[model samples]
Target: MRIDARRRAGLRAGGVAAAAVLALTLAAPATAGDATDHGRGGQDRTYSFTVMGTSDLHGNALNWDYFKDAEYDDSAHNDVGLAKISTLVDQVRADRGARNTLLVDAGDTIQGTSLAYYYAKVAPITEGGEHPMAAAMNAIGYDAAALGNHEFNYGIPLLRTFEKQLDFPLLGANATSVRTGRPAFAPYVIETLHPRGGKPVRVGILGLTNPGVAIWDKANVEGQMQFGGLVETAKRYVPEMRRKGADVVIVSAHSGADTSSSYGDTLPFPENAATLVAEQVPGIDAILVGHAHQEIAERVVTNTATGRPVVLSEPLRWGMRLSVFDVDLSFHRGRWSVEGVDAQVLNANTVPEDPQIVELLADEQATVVDYVNSVIGTSTEAMSAATARYEDTAALDFINHVQAQAVQAELTGADAALPVLSIAAPFNREAAIPAGEVSVRDVAGLYIYDNTLLGIKLTGAQVKAYLEKSAEYFKPVTAAGTYPASALTNAPTATAPNGTPDYNYDVMRGLDAPLTYDVDLGQPVGSRITGLAYDGVPVGDAQEFVIAINNYRQSGGGNFPGVTTAPVLVNRQVEIRQLLIDWVTAQQVIDPATFTATNPDWRLTWMGEPLTVTP
Candidate 1:
């Protein structure tokens, strides 16, 4: 990650000019909604246009669930993928007419499942090869798209391959080349809409991505690409879009709407800043947000500078929902003026999968199915990840075990001496390893995300701080209420505040210690974790330890304190899934007794005033 010192110096040399250019370009503009003012008698022509946006598709092109190893169907009651989204796209385009509709995605299309992994890691995008994702999006006729942080997961070379294959431009205004101080991709795209009996409507789309990519993809982008803050990038580009004669400006932000800095405010970049960009930047007409999988039908935020409304929408992940923005434009005095704006969601499940998309990607889908279903190992009994949130179940421990063993093997004598703990979260509640033979699909289901493992050095106090933050996943319990009943109230998974996803709630394994903690309803969040011990010994500040964690946490993805800058003891440079497959093949039989030899490694309990664990 260390850039060449000379290159670093060179960047610093032009830093002042870059800053000046940014300042000079971001001059405020007039309010967007005030383009036409007063007099109903003088009113001019009006026309309707529709904008459709999708985000976090994550390579789900077929109506097939990789985990189930079957074609996704309504009987199974799952949302499925892009093939289904095409159905909704057809409906919207038909209703609005093909020329009046603009379809765009907010990134995260290439790194979620075995489908994407196969293209990037297995078969690979060769000179003549066609990536299923690019083929599907091209078939769906996307106008433009934003780059999600995951776009960098397979490194720049693969991303470039996918980008070139796309018929539409990939917009990443903030993802700039450190060497050039310019955008790595197109900053924004302007699509002029042709409305009947009115001036052509110039629609501008500016894409912003999560700043967390600088950390999450540090291995791939550290010295290559530098990411600027979303607000800063938006400020620099929104004005340019307006000056380019854009009647409507839509921001396709691959970040979340949450404005608070997840990794503290010290750094210039904030991980999720769509809300900040919309509020601060004046000319935004609508915003499509992603990288946070939560769904929003539509929300309008008033621009802080102009007091004009900025409509926002987030389609749920895996192409289950499409965010639709139907805009009414009043064409007056030879220009298009904003009149009314609205946003809504169209369910992909409402219709059947598009046969054309399914037929196009059928081969790649079958290849991935064969790839993920290959047998790896055997299990004594059926294991389910469903209850890992509540109990320190074997399903989660199995992953921790594999990760810990892999980390242990990678370390030498001295590095191994420090008690190692591997922290992991149960990402899939429905994932299971059925009894008997275990295939790659079974293991993939157990660990759903595409995160690589990193073993880092941590002091006992840092470990405590880390777990305390994770403890925020639980709601506090009052002593007066019935004990366990009130305790597990918010214990249901995915109850994190500020729209934080629950999969980030991590638990650790190693040292044969249970993560026992009590939350006092009255106490502050940072103090929630107590009774923290490693092998019956209080894990104090002085004790040193080696901890294995996913690259996401190590990248400060969850805003976990002290993690982003933590010293890396080892980088396996291997995907945890392959590591697990290797571990499973070596072990042959995965018996529950092996992992359950020790007591539960973590517990999120409830307490009241004076916070004490009940007997």
Candidate 2:
């Protein structure tokens, strides 16, 4: 069996290939006696292989919730994490026989939750350190993996370090180097499957990622790496893989299968184009998708060229689900041809937690719990972000307050005199700060992303235009019929998957006229934000000012206009969460009365009519 990998480019069967295949002998991950012994006839006998995948595992290593600091179990009796799924993985591998099973992940593995943050931010991985997330997967023995957008969140060095620590190849066909225009990582990988007694078959697994990474991780990936459209890249690579003699091809797309182009035909390339890959790229047998966090159990798109059906599956985020693909092959005309292909998703809630995985990361888990438990500051009032989605909540206010204040502290002399504004979004609706001791966890929850503060200079008209683009988050209320406030916010549809995530919508805090959302929803978009002003004075197109934004938004993550059209003042490579932690640690008290003194600068009301604040 040949294991094709990296720039070495050819599968000459590495030195350890013979011994490696021995470990996957029939039933090794699971007991040998329990496996489903498949196959019945002779001569023209049929062989089968199973491909299991997980995606968007945002660092949920154990069935443990860092928020609750306890074992996680939802009302549906479902628990999450690769730990629980390990048991299911073992069972599936055993049932199908290890040699015939290939385990892979669709990406977004290293950065999420307090535990993951603790590793990436708190305790840096040294030369021989035990990275808990990588350790967990190494124990599970993944065959090949893909790189998700979040992988670049910790910067290039850390991502590359994590890559070196991995036992498998991190594939990303679209992640190209800016300088050379070549694959920065292994574009695709080949996992050779040795059937029960027949010859070995090569499975070509191609990895594609969302092009939005160029905007989302602009700070880390700007000059270093570039991402191309998924469809075009696949169109370029799939045919090449076929020429290299792959029996079956599987795509591990870190992009959603949805064909939505959120930039509205404006940004020429498609970001979430896994469906386009299946439809446009030929010779692919199956696709495993992620990044949208939707559950795609099984979907078959007819190939535009071959007319053959390509099966696609997406396991939801946070290790809550797993996608399994089974392919039956038969030797005919002296070649192994894919006879049938089936795919389905399995929930992690259905199985018990793998005690072995729990044990493997127990020490690291305990350390993270202790780190989050350590007090950072105190609050005089409980600030809840839950209502921030609908109303002005202190939780969201605290972040805006932090950003405006942080930027203010850094500015000096005449440049600082320019009217300063801040743009913030409510990341976690459930994030709160208790009116007592605040821990590292509380601050982390308040600012969920690792985005840094960026100062952009824009005129009043440009800012208004930016807000107008953001106002598009609301579905236009034609002939208004008592539209609920919740309906006034983002409701992601197929056409606009990148629509306003609660955290992506920009809320300005410097415009003086309380930029009310007296939205003319009955009218078209770009006419929502009104009553704009600065320092109680009417503001118009000529007014110029500086505004603080995160790197994500500054780089146009939500397709918001401004960064590309506005002037960039500075990008202080400081993580906002750390600044929040520092601010709280220095202040020692988060008094709502002190921080929540400013009146809301924005509100949602109907144009030429009044909209009630229900609460």
Candidate 3:
């Protein structure tokens, strides 16, 4: 098959030709299986090929500025850029030549950083144009890629624009257009590589995006398309690929594995759709997985029907690592099959950056840097992003306070009088806001996900349950204590079975009510909240009270139990980050002193011994 012109641009730009003759020298000698079977019984020959894959690029086209630059002391964090990624890509290819290599991206390549922000806000690709990301990928030579949910972050029109710019086909068997009922993009692509004295071998590649895209990016994608189940979609596509003369079939899945189950005692094991896809799809061979930002190197079972070996490999997100899988291919009876496969994780820290790739990405990098650095707002005190320990943190408190005020004003109106309790997750603790200036970037440090504020009504019982759920992040130090620590670390060893740690025990701010309970780390969830009372009265199962939280939690974004089904009082279109920016801008001076966890009465003690409360 002829390579698309745009797909071949990278090679062309470097003045390389496929038929160019070079000195006949082998970097490494071929093994005994050096002769091609060629649809005839002959000595088996192994063809060594390297597959480079990346997932969750998240628009990190440059090195992450964890501090968002000095001017924006806003404990905001940035990440390694795509330019840096280009450097890594070149090094991998240089280490392994064309005859033995394939470069691929698992997904989530379009959205995340300032470049994405700029692409969405300033110069959208849809208005008769191309996205910077697409250009970058083209220059880098991506052989094949799958659809990440974030690719739809800008909707179908923009997605089409981005896809049109891609020299390589954007593959997705699961994602389909509602209007057409056919695959939204090409179901798969095949590449043929010719070796000395042998016919070309066809490698079939199919793609699967997370079915949850319907919910995750619902606002952007719902009206335009529908995502089918991963297993069903793969079953239909894989056989078609095989029938289309494919020798070796590889799946590029924009999904992730379940690492929490293996880690043990860890709460909130974010469900990765990749694991389910791998387990269900009756695939033919290897799988390239992403979307979870997980770092893994192992073969997983994709389907029992085919008993196929699915290789789920992912490097760290944001250009931190490059995953390389070397697969040996052999042809038998006119069909290609995977002989053996091995994987490796290439850390960006170890390799020298590639200069040509760096130069190609320079303009895009500078554009994004300038955009992020443009001052949007400022803070007088160091606004922190630390959520390591669940003591009331100044930054966390500030976020809650801002959200609370916004909710109160909207729900009760400016003249109404009522105390508003706002709930937030302490997931954004990557950067500690040292005492200094705070900027819009610093506000980003307070929260990462672009979640919006959500208002809901709950009863005293629901409030207690919510608090209990938060408190689940912590576990009592003893049968009579409340001190909480890393549940994973404190978990009991085999000899100390009764000392099991509670990984889901996290304390929630707000609500001062009485509770009585016997410490049972292993008790069922509903049973664990026994004798719960709010404001000196037993919480009525049906009594409703107003509650405020982010849209992510309300929409089951974090997989929090009961949250997905919660009643919505209001869906504030304003994003939490924007609210924070507005709040800071309105104040003109943000004092860390004013920020204190108002609900200090919510205390924890282990075995009746007070644990140091540090936010």
Candidate 3, residue 491: CA error in Å? 15
Candidate 1: where are CA atoms >4 Å away?
A: 1-43, 71-78, 376-397, 404-419, 424-437, 448-507, 511-538, 541-615
Task: Say which candidate scores most in lDDT.
Answer: 1
The parts of candidate 2 lying over 4 Å away from their true place are 1-43, 73-77, 261-268, 378-394, 403-436, 444-508, 511-532, 539-615
For candidate 3, give the lDDT of residue 533: 45
**Preferred candidate (lDDT higher): 2 or 3:** 2
Q: 403-462, model 2: which lDDT tens digit per residue?
A: 877776666666577777777787877788888889977877788675777676788888
Instruction: Name the weakest run of 10 consecutive residues (lDDT summed) in model 2.
Output: 15-24
lDDT leaderboard ranking: 1, 2, 3
- The C-alpha local distance difference test score for the whole of candidate 1 amounts to 0.75
Q: Give candidate 2's root-mean-square deviation (CA, Å).
A: 7.7
